[model samples]
Target: MADEVGTYEATVTVTDDEGRTDTDTLYVHVEARDLPEALLSGPGTAIAGESRIYTLFGNAGDALLSSALWTLNGEYQESEDLGGQSSVSLKEKITFEKPGEYRLNGTLADEAGFQAQDSMNITVWSPTAHLLVTLTDTNSPVNESEVLEVDATVENLGQAKSDQPVWLTREGNVVDVIPGMELRPGETADVTLEWQTDPGDAGTHDIGVHSLNDTDSGEAVVTPGGGGDVFFAVGYTSPPPSTVAPGETVQPTVEVTNTGTATGTQTVVMLDIHGTPVESTEMTLSPGESRKVTTFSWTPTVSDLGTGDLVVQSEDDEASAEVTVQGSTHFDVEFASVVPTNTSKITPPGPHDWINVTVNVTNTGDTPGKQDIRLTRTVWPPKPTLPREQKDEVQNVTLDPGESTEVELLWWSPRTSDLQSCDGETKCYLIYTQLGIHSEDDEEYKMPYDRGGGGGGGNPPCTGPNPPPDSWCGTPVTLFSASEIEAGDSVGVSVKIYNHYASTEWRGVNIKSHHVSSYGPGSYKNWQAKLEADDSAQPGQKIKVCVTMESWAGSHLRSNYDPKAKAPAARKGSFGCSTIPVVDGGDDGGGGGGR
Candidate 1:
C-alpha cells in the first residue's frame, strides 16, 4: 500500500492452513540542518624587534568542538585539543626580526562537519640605548712634586656593542686611553691612568676624563707647597765717662750696632744706675747698622756722694756696658769770737772808739787751701752821727789748714747822760758783723754775729782793754722795730745811726730791706725811703721810715726775722700792734709809730 505524496506497499499468503492475505503502507517528508558559528579573534601590541611570549583564545558558539590551532602572519604557529567542548586556547613564542604591524589568527573544527576561524592585529617597536661613566682617586689632594693616579669605569646597557675610546687629561694635557678595546651590550670596564706633577706655585689644579661617544665624562681637583725656619746677633759700644758735681746735671751717649744677617725691631733699651734699671727706651735696627742713642740724664744729689756706675743694656739681646762717675770734697770756714783783754783807755785814740773783741777763725775741715778772709760790720740807719759814720768795715786775712786765729775788733760808745742813766732800760744799739771767706773756686763761707740788747733792752758798756791803734774798727747801730702790719695799717721802723771811731769823718750810706717773704700771689713793686746826715751831729741819731700795708690778705708778713735763728725777737712797742680783725665795709686803721 502507499500513502499520499509517495508511498509503497507489498502483501503475501501462507500455504497450509486457510488461505488469508494482509497488506501495509509507507510515507516520506525531507528538511536541511544549521552549520556551527565562526571563532572570534583580537588585536595585539608588542615591543618591536624583540622576542615576546603570547597566548591565543578561540570561541565556537553552539558547536561541538574537536581541535584548535593558531597562525602568526599567515603561518601555523601552535595547536590545542578541545575534547568535545565549544571553546579552545593556544600559546606561541614569537620573534619579530623587523619592526612593523602584523596579523595573527585561530581555527577550530568538529566531527559533525562544522568549522570556525578568528584573526587579530599586532605591532612592534625598537629598544633604547644607555651608557654610564664614573671616575675615582685612591689618594686625593696631590702635592706639587707627587705622582697622581686616577681610575675610571664605563658601562653600556643596550642590545648592541660599542667601541668607544676613554681619554684622561690634566690641565689640558691629553693622557692614555682605557684599554683601547670595545664594549658589548650589558658590559662594564675599569681603567687606571697615572701622571707626575712638576713643582709649581701653590694653588689648585683640575684633572679631567673624557669618552669618544661624548656620553661619559668626569673631573677632580688637586693642590701644591708652603712655610719653614729663620737667625740674629746684637752688640753695644761703651759710653764715655762724664763729670758731675753734687748738684749738677749731665747727659751721656751710647751706641748700639746690629751685627747679624736678619733685621730686628725694638725690644727694649735699658739704662741702669748701680745695677738697677732707672729708665728704658725702644729702637729698631737693620743688619750691619749702628744707632747713637741719648738714653737719659743723671743728676747727682747730696745722697749720691761717692763713686757710682752707670750701665746701659740692650734688653732684646742682653748686651751691656758700664761708665764711671766721680765725686769731690768741700770745706767751710767760721769765725768763733773776737774779744778784748782789758778795760784800760788808750792815749792816742784808735780808729775804733770802743774796746776790743778778739776774733777766733777756724777752718772746719782738714784740707789745706788758700782763702781770702774778710770781716764786715753793718751799722743801722746807714748814715753817721757825730765823730764817725756808721759804715761797714772790711778786713782780709789768711788761715792755715784746720787752724784758727784770734784778733781784736774795736768800737767806741760815747758817754752821755741820757744813754748812761737809761742803759739797762732803753733799747741799745746793735752791730751785725759777718765774716766771709772766699776761695778761687768761688765758694763762699759766711759767719754772722749779733751784739745788741735782748729784745728791746739796752746793752752794757764794754769792760775790756782798748784795742791797738792799727786794729780793725766796728760800729754799733740799734734796730728797734721791723714788723708786719694789717691791711691799711701804718708801718714805722726806727734805727739808731751812731759812730764808734775816734776821728770825725763823714761817709755816704744807703739803707735797703728785701721783702723776701712779704709777697702775695701776683707781682710786687719795691717800697723804698731815703735819708742823709753828716758826722758832726750828735753821738747818736735816730732814723725812721714808714710803710703802708696793701688791701689784701697774704701768707707772708710785711717783716721777717733772721732766717738762721731758732728763736727771734718779737715786734713790740708803738711800732707793733695786735692783729686787727678784718671787718666788712669799713676803712682800715693805720699802723702805730715807733721812737
Candidate 2:
C-alpha cells in the first residue's frame, strides 16, 4: 500500500531431504498497490433456502485484502463476517431463509484499514423445497371414487435443515402443505399426497401436482369420457364470509377461465364437499378468456353450521375455499392441528407417559365469545352400552371472531385398562378432542409391548421413589422460550418461565436481546429475559435473544430439541415453559419473530 515503488534483489535456493542443494535465478518486481475496493457478484433473484455462491473480488481479485465483510439489508438484516487477510478465495455461499428483497453489501478492507463497499439488490423466493411430483396410480379411465395418489419426492438441497411446511400443489395451486417435513441438508423425503377424485364426473380429467418451482411437468389422466379439445379452469373471484349467521344468504362469485386452445361454452356450478351441486351458471369464453358468475343466494340453516367449503366446479377442474357458518349461538369453534410439546414420543405414543399436547383452535363466529372446549378419550367407534369413554380435559377457550389460539393439555398416557374394551384386531383405539357442534381431531397411542420390563421410557411414573431414575431424576431441557424480542421507544419487555419437571430444579434463567436497554448487557441469572431491540434496527431487522437455564447439579441442558423426538416430557400440574425452553409451548416463553 506504500506510494514508494522499488525493485530489490531477490534470491532463491532449494534443498533436498538428502545433503544436496540447488539454486535458480530469481527476479523481483515491486510497485505501489491500489486501495482495496469491494466487488460483489451474485444472482439478483434467489430461492429462500437454496444456497448460492457469491464472490467478492477486490480490485478485480488483485488487491491485498485484509478482510471482506458481507451484510444483508432491506427486508431483513444479516451480517456475515467473512474473509480474513489470508483467505484463499473470496467466494462464499449464502442461503436466505425467508423470501424478501435484500441488499447484499460487500466491503473489503486493506491492511491500513482503508475500505471500499459495493452491493447488489436481491429478491428471494419462498419455494425453497424442490419436489419431483409424479402420479402413483396406473389405472386408466378410473372410477369416480377411485383414489389417486400423488408422489412428491421433496428434497432439501440447501445447506441447512428446516421444519418449514412442504405444500402439495395441484394445477399450479396449493392443495395441501404437509407440515414438519423436517429435512436436513441434502436430505430427500417421499411425501404421499392424496387427491380424491370428484364423486360423479365421467370425463377426461387432467390432474397433477405442483412442483412449486415450475419444474414438475408430470400429469395424470384421472377419468376418461370425452376427449375435450376445449377445457375450462374454474376458481372463485370473491372470497367467502369469515362467519355467516344461520339462514343468511351468501353469494360468492365464481370465475371460469378457458385454458383450452378452442372456444368453449361450459357451465360452472357451485358444489359442496360431497360434490353435490348447489347452483349453476353457464357462459361462453374464447381461449384465454375469463368470466365471472355469482352463486344464486345459498342460505345455510342451523343444521349447516360449523365449517364448510365453497366449492366451484367447471368441466373437469375445480377449486374450493373454506367457508364458515355460525349458528344461532355467537360462537363456533374450529379445531386445527395438534402439536406435542414436552414429549418424548410422537409415533406410536407410549402408555402411562406424561406429555403436553398443544391444540390449535380458531373462533370463526361473528362476535367475541368465551367457552370451554372439552377433549374426550374413548375407544374408537364407542358403543354407548359398553361405556368406557373417559372425559379427559375441559379447557376454556376465549377469542374474537376469526382469531385462533392454542391450548395446552397434559395427557397422561392411557394405561392397560384404558384399551381393555377395544378389540386389538380392529385397532381403532385412539385419543379424541371435540367440542359441542364442532368437528374434532384425534391422536392415537399404543400399549407398550413389554410393560413389566420398563423399556423405551414407557414405564408408568414411579410410585415409590427416593433418588429416582436417570431421566426421571433430572433431565433438564428448555420447555419454552420467547419467539422474538422487540425493543423500541418505551420498550417494556417481560419474559416468563415455568417448570414442567418437579425434580429438575432450575437454578436460574435469563433472556438477553441484541441491544442494551434497561436490562443488563449480557445474559444473567434471572427469571425473565426482558430485553429490547436496538434503536437503529429498521424494518425486517431481527432482534436476537438468548434464553438459557442453569441446572444445579443435574443433566446437561438440551437446547432446541424437537418434542416429536425422544427428549423430555412434562410432569403433571406443570404448565407453560422457559423453565427451560426452545419450544413454543401454549404460552410463548419469549417474544416472536423479527418485529
Candidate 3:
C-alpha cells in the first residue's frame, strides 16, 4: 500500500526495568513512507592520473534523518546531509593514484532509524588505448628540400572503439593528422605524416602527437639547410577566348609577383586541364616585383580543344586560374560599327526609283557562322502614297571565320507626294538596320533640308521615274532605249533630261531615277553627262542644256571619247560617245533644270 504523503508527529512509548506501569515517551517525526533506494555510479575503469566523477542517488525511506553515508571498501569515508529530502542525489569527484578495483557505497537513513544501502564496485585501470608519437629521424639539421617523418602508434586495448585521431602538433598548433587512427577494440594502427624543411624552417620546432583519452609525446630537432627562398603569388590572368578552331593561336596573359627576399626566377605555364604544359614563359623578378607575361602563346590543334589552366609556379608556391578551349559558333554584328558609329545614323537619300542600302558584315569568330541581315523601312508621319509601309528584306550570308563581305538591299522609294508631305514635318523614313537575329540599329533617310515649294530643290516635279538612258531617250518616243548605239550611227535631238536629285551628298548611286528602277552602276546614266560631251555653247540655266551626240560615228560606241568633254569617268560617265548618252535640249522646260 502506498503511504500517505505528509509530515506527522508520532509518540513512541517504552518501559524498561519498571515492574509497575511506568513509560518513557519519545516523540518521532514521521514522514510519508517511501521505498529505500540508492544508486552509486562511477566509471567501471579509469586511468590512474585522470580525475573521474562518482555520483550517489538515494531515497530517505520516511524523510527523517535524510542523511547519507558514503564508504569505500567498507571503510567510512564521509557523511553528507541529504537536507532531509526524501529523494536526493550526491556527487563526488574521485581520482585514483594507483590502478585497482574499489568498492563504493551510499547508505541512507529514515525517520524510523531504519537504514538502506546501495553498493557498487568500480575497476580502475590504465587507459586502454595509449597513444605515442616518435620522431624517428634525428634530423639535427634539415635542408629546405628535406622531408621529416613522424610516426604515431595508437592501440585501442579496450572493448570499445576509440575515435580521437592521432595528430602531430608544432608549438601546440596541429600541423598534421595521422591517417587511420580510429582504433577498433583491441586493434592497433600506426600512421606517419611529414613536415618538409624550408629555408625559413631553420630554427628548432617542437613536434608532438596527441589523442583525447591518453597521450605520450616526443620531439624532433631540425636545423635549417639550403632550400627554397623565393615565393610567387599569382595575381590575374587575361585568358584567351573560351572557344576556338583547330590551329587557332591564342595568347594568355598572366601576372605573377615575387614576395620573397631573394630575386626569384620562375616559369608561368599554360597547361591543359590534364597538367600537360601547352606553353611556358620564364621571367626573373626582384623581390616585390610583379611581371605580366605575354611572351608565350599557344597554338591549339584540333586535338587540344578542351578545358585548361594557366599556372604560375615557383619552388615553394603555385597559383592557377581556369580556362576553357572548345569550338564555338558565336554571333555578333554591328551597324557602321554600331550606333552611327557612336551617334544617331544618318545617310543620304537613295535613288528616286528605289532606295538601296549596303551593309558591310564581317565574321569575327574563329568558326564559320550564318548572319541574316535585314533592312526594313517604316515611314513616320505616315503619308498617303507612303501608306505607313513596312517592307522587310533579309539576306542570309554564310561567312567563313575572319571573312568579310558587302551586302545590298533595296526598297520602294517615297513617291513625289510622300516627299512633299515630309517638307514641313518631322516625317522621314525610319530605316531599321537589323543584324544577326534580334539586334537592331537604325538610321534615318530624312527629307531634303531644302524642300522648296517648286519640288526637288526647284527642279521640275517628277511624278514618276525619269526615262532611263540607253532606251526610249535615244530617239525620244521610246521610253527605254537600246543598250548601245550601232556602229556609224549618230543622232541628236532636243528634249528634257530631268535629273532632280535633292543633294550632292547622294553619290556612288544614281539619285534622280524615278517612276522606274535603273541600275546602271558605273555607267554615266544621268543628264549631266549629256551636256558635258557637247562642243556647242552651254545653256545658261543650270538644269537646261544642249547636247550634240555624234556617237563616235564610225565606231558605233564612243571609240574616241573626248577627255576635253570634262566628264568624270569614275563617278559620272561610262562607255558612251563623248559625254553620257546626250539629253536633247527641250523648248517648254526653258533654261530651268529639268527631270
Q: Pick the candidate with the highest TM-score.
A: 3
Provide the lDDT at 73 for model 2.
80
RMSD of each: 46.6, 32.1, 25.1
Candidate 3 C-alpha lDDT tens digits along 1-595: 2255554454555566865454455444445455577788777877756777878877655455468888878888788866567777788777755445788887888766678787887776554544333344434445543666776666665455665555555555444454336666656666775554445655677776666544455666666566446566764477666665567686767678878776645545444444434455556677789888776566766455567664544334555666566654444443332112211212323335444456667766665667667765543334456544455477878877678777666555544445433335432322211122221322323222122111111222224566322221221212122212222223222323333333211222222221222323222234332122224434331222223221111121112332233211211211112222333345443222322
Over the stretch 1-595, how does candidate 1's per-residue lDDT look in tens digits?
Answer: 2234443333443465566555454333322334444444333666544666655555554457778777778888777777887655556677765445677776777756566676767775435333345675535567643556787776654456665545555554333345343677667877776544433413555566655333333444346442211011334444435445555665556666666444544323343344333444445566677777675566656455445556554522344444334444223434444332323422212234453434455555334344443333322212233321222333444554466665444444333321211114432322222233333333332212222221111222222345332111222322223332333333333322222333221221223332322322222223233222222323223324332221111112111223333222222111111222222223533222221
Residues 175-209, candidate 2, lDDT per residue (tens digit)? 34354567765577777765444434455544554
Residue 167, model 1: lDDT of 53
Clashes of each: 21, 14, 17
Alpha carbon deviation, residue 324, candidate 2 (Å): 4.9
lDDT of each model, Cα atoms only?
0.42, 0.49, 0.49
Candidate 3 C-alpha error for residue 256, in Å: 5.8
Lowest lDDT 10-residue stretch of candidate 1: 550-559
Task: Show where candidate 2 strays beyond 4 Å.
Answer: 1-4, 7-95, 98-105, 108-152, 156-187, 190-316, 319-595
